[model samples]
Target: MSLFSQAFRPVGSTRADPVLVALWVALILVAVIWIAPFVFIVFTSLKTNTAVMGETAFALPTDPAFSNYAKAWARGNFSVTAFNGVLITFVKVPLGVFLSAMAAYALARVPMRGRRVLFLLCVFGTMIPFQVMLAPIFKQVNAFGLINSYPGIVLPYLAFGVPYQVFILYGFFSAVPKELSEAARIDGASHFTIFRRIFLPVSLPALSALFVLDFVATWNEFAMALVILQDPQKWTLPLGLMAFQSQFQRDYGQLNAAIVMTVLPAAIVYLMFQRYFVAGLTTGAVKE
Candidate 1:
C-alpha cells in the first residue's frame, strides 16, 4: 500500500486508530526536527551579519538582505567550485554505478568460482572505514603524481563507493528470475548483451536511485577531495565551502548563503530522482 493510503487508512468503520495517529504525530515531529536547521539557515542567509549575531537564530530577518547571496556567490568563488563539483560528481557517480552494476551482474548471474566469497569480500570492504584507507590512498595517488587532479579524487571515490553499490545491486540482480537468463541465452544473447539490454533496462529504478545517492555523496565529499586535491583551483564544493567559512567566519549571512548554495545541487538531484528512490530501496524486500 502507498504511504498516503496506509497513513490515512481507517480502522473498523468509524474513527482513526490511535496507533496511526501517534505515528503521524511522530513523523511530523521528526520532519520538523530535520527541517529546523535548514529553515534557520535560510532565515540567517537573508539577514545581515549584525542581525544574525544579535537576533535569535530562529528569528525572521527584519530587513532581508538578498545581497548576501550575491556576496556569497562572488566571495565563495562558487562559479569555479560549482563547475569543479559538477565535473567530479557527473564523472565519478555514473561511472561508478555502471561499473558496480556490471560487477553485481557477474556475481549474480555468471557461473564463477568462489563468487560468494568475492561478494563477501566486497561487503567486508564496506565495513572498512574510509579514514583507515586515506593515508594509503594519498600515498598511492602522490606516487602517481595525481595530487590536485580529478582522477586522483575520482579513483578513490569509486573504490570506496563500489562495495556498497555492489551490495545493493547484487541483491536486486540476484532476485531476477533465472528463466529470463536461460531464455536470453537460448536466443543467442551474449552475457554482455543480456546485461546491457535486459538487466540494465529493467534495473532503471535501482540505477536511478543509486545515481542520485552517489551524486549527492560525491558532490558533498570532503576529506577525500581535501587530501587528493591540494590546489585551490581544483577544490570541490565542500572544500570550497570550508575555505569560504574560514575566510568569512564573522560574516554569518554570507556563510549561511554559501552553505545553501552548496546544498542546492544535491537537493535538486534528490528531488529529480525522488520517485524512483523508495521503490529502488524496496525492490527486493518481498517475494511473491
Candidate 2:
C-alpha cells in the first residue's frame, strides 16, 4: 500500500490493497470467461478438420494446421464477399449519419407546432417490431423494382438504421447549449450552415462512436441481406459465410476460420472508435 493511502484509511476499514487485489482478480476472471470462446475459435481454426470433428472437441489439436485459413478463404469466396460488405458499410454508414443527424437536429431544435407529436410518432416507429414491418417494406421495395439491387438492400438498412440513430442523436442534440445556436444566428449563419459547421463539428466524438457501431451493424447484418440480395455477385460476407457452411461438408475448421475472418474488420473498426465511448465532463458546458 502507498503510505499516503494507508495514513488516510481508517483502522477498522479494509485495506485498499486487498480490495483492489480482489477487484482485479474478479475482472480477470470475467475477461477470461468472455475471451475463452474467441480463443477456442482461433485454436479450432488452426486444427485440422478431422481433429476438430474428433471425440475431444475441447482439446487442442496435436499439430496446428494453418492451411485451413487459405482453404476457407478460397472456398468461401471471401474476397468478393468482403469487398461487398466493405462497399455496403461505406455507403450506408455516412448516408445514415447525415440523414439521422439532420433529422434529429430538426426534431430537437426546429420550432414548429405539433413538433412534439411528430417526434413522438417517429419514436413510436422504433417500438413497432421490425418483423411486422418486413412484409410492407418488401412489398414497397418490390413495387419500386428495387429487389435484388443494392439500393433495395441499402435503403431498408437506412430505414431501420435512421430511427435508432435519430433516437440517440436527438437526445444528444437536445442537450446542446442553445446559446451557441443563438450566437451563430446573430453572426448571420443560416440554420443549415450552423448545423454543418458549428453543431456538427462539436459532435465529433459522438459521431465517431455512432459511425463505428452503424458500420459494424451494416457489415454483420445477415437476415436482411439474405432476403434482398438474390444475386451471387451482391452477396455480403455474412450471407457468403452462410454459403460456406452449407456448401462445405460440415468442415468446422474452415467454418471457424471463416468466422474469424468475418469478425476481423468489425473488431478493428470498434477498437478504432472505442475512444469515444468514454464520457468526458469538460468545463463550460451548459445544463441545457
Candidate 3:
C-alpha cells in the first residue's frame, strides 16, 4: 500500500497506523540528534575565534562574523581540497558505477559458463578490509612512482569502492524482470543497447543515490589519502584540516569554520540529489 492514500481513497480512511506515526516521530528525532553536530559546527563557523572560545560555544555569536568562512578557505586551502575532491569524485563515480553495473548485469542476467564463480569472486573481494590490503597496494603504486599523485589517490578510490558498488548494482539489476529484457532482445536490440536504454534509464534513481554516496565517501576519505599522499601540496581537505589542530594548541574556531567549508559541497550535492536519493533508497529497498 502507498504510504499516503490517494484522493479517491478518503483521507484518514486507511489503517489508523499509529505505529507508523510513532516510527516517523522516532526517526525524525533520531535524525535531529544525528544532525546536531553539523548544526553546532555551522554555528561555530559563523562566529569569530574569540566568540567560539568565549562563553558562546553553544550560544549564538554576538556579531556572527561570517568571514570565518573566507578565513577557512584562505587558511585551509579548502578550495584546492574541494577541487581535488571534485576531480576524484568525477573520475571515480561514473567509472565505478558503470563497471559495477556491468559486472552486476552480467552476473545476474547472463548465463555465462563461470557465472557462479564470478559471483563468488565478487562477494569474496568485498570481504577483505582495504586496510589489510593497503600495504601491498601502496607498494605497487610506489613501484610505479604514483605515490603523492592524483592517479595514486584515484586508483585506490575506484578499487575500494568497486566491490560494494557491484554488490548493490547486481542485486538491483537481478530484480529486473527477465520478460522485459527478453522482449528487447526479440526486438533486435543488442545487449549493450538493451542495458543502456532499458535498464540504465529505469535505474536512474539508484544511480543518483550511488553518486551521492560515492562522492561523499571519496571526498571525506582520510586514511588512504593520508597514507598514499605525502606531499603537503597535494593534501586533501581532511588532512589539511588536521593542520589547524596540531598548530599552537588547536584553534577550534578556524577548525570548525574549515569543517563547515569542507561540508558545503557535499551538502549542496545531497540537497540537489535528495529527490533521487529518497527514491533510490526506497526503490532499492523494495524486495524482488
Shift in Å, residue 25, candidate 1: 0.2
Question: Where does candidate 1 stray beyond 4 Å?
Answer: 1-11
Model 3, residue 249: displacement in angstroms? 5.5
Q: Of 1 and 2, which scores higher on lDDT?
A: 1
**Candidate 3: worst 10 consecutive residues by lDDT?**
1-10
Q: How much does candidate 2 score in TM-score?
A: 0.86
Model 3 residue 6 lDDT score: 34
lDDT of 3 by residue, 100-194 (tens): 88878888877779987877877888898888888988898899999989999888888878888878888888888899899988999888888
Tell me which of candidates 1 and 3 scores higher on lDDT: 1
| Model 2 RMSD in angstroms | 4.0
Residue pairs whose backbone atoms clash in candidate 1: none
lDDT-based ranking, best first? 1, 2, 3
**What is the lDDT, from 0 to 100, of the residue 28 in candidate 3?**
78
Local distance difference test, per candidate?
Answer: 0.91, 0.83, 0.80
Q: Residue-wise lDDT of candidate 2 within 1-288, one digit each (tens)?
A: 365456545578755556655666688799999999998988888887778877365687779888889999999898988888988889999999999999888888888888788778778867877667777878898899998888998999998888888887788888888999989899998889989987798776677778988888899998788777888888999999988988884787888999999999899988877776433222124553
Clashes of 1: 0
